[model samples]
Target: MNTLALRLFAIWLVVFGSVGISLASEFFSEAEKTIIQSFGPWPPPLIADPSNSVSQNSEAISLGKKLFSERRLSLGRDLACSDCHAPDQFFTDGTALNSAHGRATRNTPGLLNLRWSSWFGWGGAADSLWAQSIRPLLSKEEMKFTGKKLRELFSEDIALTQKVQELFEISVVDQSDEALFVIVGKLLAAYEETLISGLSEFDRFNVALSASDNIGIESYLATAKRGLKIFIGKGRCNLCHFGPTFTNGEFGDIGVTQFITKGRIDKGRYQGIKALQSSPFNLLGEYNDDQQGTSRVRTEHVTLQHRNWGEFKIPSLRNAVKTAPYMHNGSIETLAGVVEFYSNLDEERLHIRGEKILRTLNLTPQEKKDLVAFLRTL
Candidate 1:
């Protein structure tokens, strides 16, 4: 072959080889996508089922909603669930930190689409809603009432006691301490399971996008779409906060606030799991008959790994704008603040192994605004 022809032939061979490799790479990427799509949905739906058996009854729901707002449930007769999770504020009252008789160690997460969660609390302490409701009742900073004193209140208040008794078919006994605690927990759980939240604008927008009605969605509303791109793509939020509920329903060290408050290192999930193990009010306790045997099995057999330290339950993003002071410790105060935290997360402070990838994204100003705007739509 001529020298010029030989050079062209070599160039063609290299180009063809590169193109073949590129085609294989593309095929592998698509295959990965096909495997994921085979699971029926990309972001799996939340507990959107209206016929949730645990909270299907109208009477139970009504009582639960009323009780949710009642402050008298606390020992000080002041801090009800509504004190933190008010209905008007998408169930959260927008506190940087929760306080009642005393300040709480963590933020008050909103109660939106909770019917779908298999676990509750920042540590995944409770396996069911009924079981989850009992935590605040026993906490000194929350309700602060012992099971015995709570029963006394039930006994003294005839109407209150009667309502509870009729609802659960159990009498409030002054002497039987165990029975009183059990009944109180059960009644409250029945109430919480009913505190479901309304659908957000994000859900509708997602539905629109799913149906290929992209033009019908607004450009300003496109901020949320861009945020969604960042979240599931370069933002890397989907590593932990995945699925339609915007949570993997697992634990992680998301670089929240542990060192920010001097001397108040709330050991995150490490101590939380230990506390759950010892807690009598927990689902494995004698009070947890309603969760079937599922609660007992989980509590008794559960094991905690070392990495669980500083790991907290991933809260749903359905009402992200409503619940301020994000994280288990309620350290960050606003949605914008939260975006900023993740954007500029100090890698030196993160406490997990092999966590080199959580470097500061150095998000642009517009990216930050667009991200916050999107979170608000949720």
Candidate 2:
């Protein structure tokens, strides 16, 4: 070859190699690498709706907070909202199953980012926050307070009753306990709307991402980054648990075999849908219709299906690290164990019905570790 051609080829190779090395170096930089490593690299707005209308008023929230701890609202003045949902333990009592004042049929979920939830309970029965409150109050195992008893208690406590009346902007109907129950439910709903947790390490990472601030996010996104990869890839967790709330908000069978042992089985959303449709405390109830307008979105599209047998409400992962004994039945003990359960999933125990949903994730030990590390950061 000619000397001139050889020289030109050598110069081109040097320039190309230099550019490639520079790009590779930037990609693997300490700060850049660490931020990329953090779990759930997505922004907070992607996880939950920050501007939920339920979080608007302070007075309503305060009133709701006060009523939440008050036992007078219950049947025998024995139970309060705090009985099931405790604040110190991330707003959930952290029990596998919650015993109301007596027996509980299901687990107590953490009230972390409930405003983002479209439905309440394991069955997605209640459509609104106010509607969710009524279930426990009337449940046989829960508060078990009725109309007659509630009215008597409200009448006896003049100051408390007056407070309720003033806060709700309506008087308690003299004879029926239904009106008082509705008021208290609404107040409790208002209070629960204020329990949103502030920005965590995950939130900070999102901020860094928006401004392309690589150095600022590196430290916070450590284990979380590694976990995020496992979650999206081998862990296969992102299929059901996909959004900012770490949930697609769809019901799925997570391989809990409680119903299999029982023989008859708890027909999850199927029964729940019928009960919610016929409920008096529902958003479409006469009480709500009279108080609010008829235009409210209540239990409209909620329906029952065969696949909903073991289905439960998909929970938010805001204070997920603190709220232990995961899932609807609280079957899994720790976050690490929960990840392992999904990793080496035993299909034998899973009653998948007609749908081919829960399958063995086939994750390695290191992959499980990475997934657990990521969950703790949430």
Candidate 3:
């Protein structure tokens, strides 16, 4: 090993000698320690959603949780949001494309840590969590419920009707379909915001580093420690997948194919921008509860571009072990498959105007294993 590497090892020895533990995970430089510290202190602060009126209200969240699995909300009285976003499966239906309903165009992303996300969906079609909640309800391919259907369902469902009246302070029958739609969306968003993942083994390791608790560090998986170095070091995974929630909450084109069907290509953020600008529920629209006007800044200024055609949201990696198959359309079946794709990335799949950030990693076999071991701790 070189001087720095030897020093990194020596520091580990000195730190752990008193604790009487000798583990491969103990190696670290001051620089590496700083980078590792950036991962977290897990479970980031919950910011209030200015666009959703009932953002953190407990009553709304309770009702929304009930509504999440309420099958009657669908037109056919069959599908519910939970049907695709199964609660047991990290709130993600472990499928590439959810065919539980009609046929979804993209993978069902996990609901963990959504309160920290600035944008929602793979294509980022909505600006607020409430707006995104409204999507599956209205889509014919998902919950398959229209505003009119919701009005009818709420009218006859005595228990839900009573809950809506108590929380909203308005009878469901008195409200327009549009008003009811917004109300339900806000309620759901209030509940979805609570779906945060607990701290993982990686978080514990980060904490140990912060306290210089060498024995605590030794408890962390040795291979995972090496992998964590690769993630924040030469692999540069931290550039996109950094911070407490493990994502930057932005879109990117990482050479993943955008073809949804043979002829019907998923235009990703290109079409998402069009839909977002036109959506009546967007943060730029009248339904936004934020009176301060600052909450809509991102939605107000986003410009459409050709490069956005294939770009998709960079999802948080907190619950990666629970959410699969991976990628935008769920093309990759396993986490290792995702790693392999990046290891020998096919850059030709990317368009000329696409992001230049990605290149073939060409990771060694052992490197791939180490990297995957780190990801598991996430």
Candidate 4:
């Protein structure tokens, strides 16, 4: 190859440490550029949760932060939300399924950048963040506390009672079990909403792309660029895990087992729809503070289908490096493992009713490593 062609080729070449990377304006297609640009503009537009009146409230955020670590929410008064969602561990306990208070069926999901998400949890079971917050305290396999227990904790505690009164301008003693329960959930969500991830290396590369800074673009590794081509190209990951937050905020069944026990199945989004529709805490319910009812449409129209049986939320790929044991069940241990799973995906293992979006990528070993290198920048 001539100097011009060689230089251009080297821009896409995989390199090791100390070897500088580069990107040419002509490297990616117009479509690829559009897809790459869609990954960010870091820290997406901050929209307050209408369902939770105290979503952005300062007092609510403070109180919620306290409550997140408060063990009193648990029936045993031993487990706290922070125990499973450790701050240093990126709000995940680093376990496949958290067996803290008890054996949790699904993996403990990261709590960062939750404000951007309309639906919550692996199955998108909770239509609102506050409702999702209440789940840990009520789950039989988790903290396993009841509404009455939660009400008692707040009502009986002198300091908590005062805070509750000050925050809501109402005494906790006067509130019913369900009412107090909702208040705590709202407060927890308020604090949780602020837990956003910072700009990753990928975001910086995106900034370079936007500015047409060839030097700035060079900072992104060459192997990653190859992986990026695959990601937005043949891998078709951007189809689902696209846009800001790196997810479509929809569910997919990527051939993961849904079995909870011998013959017992988790019934992912199918049961999630049923739970959301029946729950009083859903966006359409009375507890929602959205007097305008602006956020109720998604919840109102959600219907259960046989296709949803094995479907789980396509989690945000932001900070994918920190949150380990990937998938709803936390079955994949490493980023490489996750890549491997998709690379050799079993179509037969997929739900019969599930969409035929996924197929075995059959990635070569170098392709796998390159993809992982690209993912780490996120």
Candidate 5:
């Protein structure tokens, strides 16, 4: 009932609102801040693989892009790299097993961020990207192309042969079939190195949060934030899915069944190590461009043991929402299924010496929903 009283109330409201906003700025706890900081500044530095001489060469990338889509690289001349790794589907074929040749045992992973990977394939079979590129071409379950077949193709295709000569400085007539095969792999790897994933909503949030700017991160959903808290906290997901690319880039057996049929067992990294060591195309082999042999250290000293029996490479979670049919066997069909698998993890199924990092999460239904929400932002 008085002008002075009304003015005083209005001033108090404004002051209280300002104080509330100030307090809200310190929303994240100290532990949460550290976790957020570790996630990134977005677009991590490109890792260099010295084993491939043309890893970053522009001409090699161009030739590789052309070659990646060339079906003639396969035995049947019907399957190309793009057959399993289609560009429109975020590089994944969205299938459990690649059936371009026959049905591949392992799931076809997306090719994004291969430059940062220390190893390639589900089992980490290849130490170098170039070597990994060559494996599928030679595998019976994949492209099934021999060195002789590839050599013949190169000799016959005048334009492709000329491009190879101009780009790699190798004469098809003079080079051995194996050497030509390796050269093609190197070019394919050069193109794959450029397939980096773009920034996501999570990356933007991390950038703003790292800078201590609360206003800049207003677009981030509250449910997603709660889910992120669960991910870095109780979910223990950060133990494997950490760093800028959201993966440790290592192998683990999280209790997924590895049996292909009745008697056959997919002895993942155990077999991978044997294959990598025996292969002539391995980084430690003569084909490696790195004369210094610095990149061969991982290959030379890699430990093989019974624990690696069912292990598979921990895939990067970037664009994981887009690439479905999760896991090495593609047994988990949805993101929700993946979350449920972790939540109700079967410890008995794991190897006796399997990773000690995993355990039953016992997440509430709401918590599982929140975690999935957070993953979608990636």
Candidate 6:
């Protein structure tokens, strides 16, 4: 024991700490940077929907918020849109399927970032957000109200009807039940469009990386960074889940079972396309707000084929950590389970010929954990 021994130990400690700090300060690799860049900048621009005239109307948004929480919108007066899309849980009721008149055929998706979506619903049945909003109100399985019932309810409430007239400048009493219903849907859509997700940890990371600030990178978890690499590279998750919202807003069939019940097979996009074409509330219909007929293009030219069978909309990954169980059927209970589903994906069950994007990842246990870690940051 001596002064020299103490000095040598102190030098060793300093050297070891310096090495650790250097490792922590390391930047992303060139290949990894390329992949990360593809995800683009975070907090994407707020794009208005041409199909919904009131999409940016403040008064409409206010009315829509009230209508969203109004239980009278449903048949039995037992449920409101808020009942399923609870604001507390990131607008999802945290159920695989919501039960109102009957069990919902699909999971209740979060309402955040609906303004950016080209289509709505798991099957993309509704070509516009307003059209999608009107669907559940008329659906026997959901709100369980006919156009007549909705019109009658509004007609009875003189104050409510008057307010609607003042805000929308439409005579609810004189308008046909269908026309009134469409307006209500449009108002609801206006409010829902405002439910944009806030900035997240990943978003901050992107900001830091873009600024070339070493201290900013410290805000993101190292484990999450590794997972992001896997997501864009080996996991191939970016193929379906790319963009600021971590979704391409397109439909895909990734081998998840399409059966909702023994007798019923949820045909997904195949049935959605058929329903969209037949829908009176569709974007191509007379009710569309777009005078230029530009917004109807997706619905007008949408191709329906056998390949669309069992395909479902790619859910956004933003706030995915909060909304679970996952998938159209809510078949997976946890984010970990979702990762596992893709990890050991059954290639045999997949429409390999139709959707060549999906394949069995065969991710190792560590890789699965890493992918899940990355998703949680979303």
Q: In candidate 6, what are the lDDT values of residues 34-120, reduced to their tens digit?
A: 667656575577877777878888988998999999999988887788988899999998988887568788899889988888889
**lDDT of candidates 1 onward, in order:** 0.65, 0.67, 0.85, 0.87, 0.85, 0.84
Write candidate 4's Cα lDDT for 1-378 as tens digits: 899998777665645212442236667878889889989899888988988989899989999999999998898899999999999999999999887765878998998998889889888889999999998788888888997787677657888778778888887778877788899999999999999999899999899988987767877888888889888888989989988799999998887888988898999988889889888788888889998887898888898887888889989999999999899988899999999988987777663655587778999999999899999989
Q: What is the lDDT of residue 286 in candidate 1?
A: 60
Task: State how far residue 88 of model 1 sits from its true place (Å).
Answer: 1.9
Question: Ranking under lDDT, best-scoring first?
Answer: 4, 5, 3, 6, 2, 1
Q: Give, for candidate 3, the lowest lDDT window spanning 10 residues.
A: 17-26
Predict model 6's lDDT versus the native.
0.84
Candidate 3 wrongly placed segments (more than 4 Å):
1-26, 348-351
| Span of ten consecutive residues with least summed lDDT in model 5 | 17-26
Q: Model 1 over residues 209-273: C-alpha lDDT tens digits?
A: 44434333332265665675576567777666666677767667777656536776767667768
User: Over the stretch 1-378, how does candidate 5's per-residue lDDT look in tens digits?
Assistant: 499998986786587746644653566688878987898866888866688888888888999999899999999998899989999999999998777666788888999988888989988889988989998888888888987798789768988889788877767789877788899899999999999988899998888777756555655777788889899988888999999888999998888888987898899888998888788889878898997878888788887887788888998998999998999888888898999999998666553757687888889999989899999999
Q: Which sections of candidate 4 miss by over 4 Å?
A: 1-23, 348-351
What ranges in model 2 sit over 4 Å off? Answer: 1-55, 289-298, 347-351, 354-358
Model 1 regions more than 4 Å off: 1-54, 218-220, 290-292, 295-301, 351-357
Measured on C-alpha atoms, candidate 1 has an lDDT of: 0.65
Deviation from native of the Cα of residue 133 in model 3, angstroms: 0.9
Instruction: Please give each candidate's TM-score.
Output: 0.78, 0.80, 0.92, 0.92, 0.92, 0.92
How far is 213's C-alpha from truth in model 6 (Å)?
Answer: 1.5
lDDT for position 108 in model 4: 87
> Where does candidate 5 clash, by residue pair?
none
Query: Over the stretch 3-70, how does candidate 3's per-residue lDDT look in tens digits?
Result: 99999978987876655453333477778888788878887778888888788899999988988998
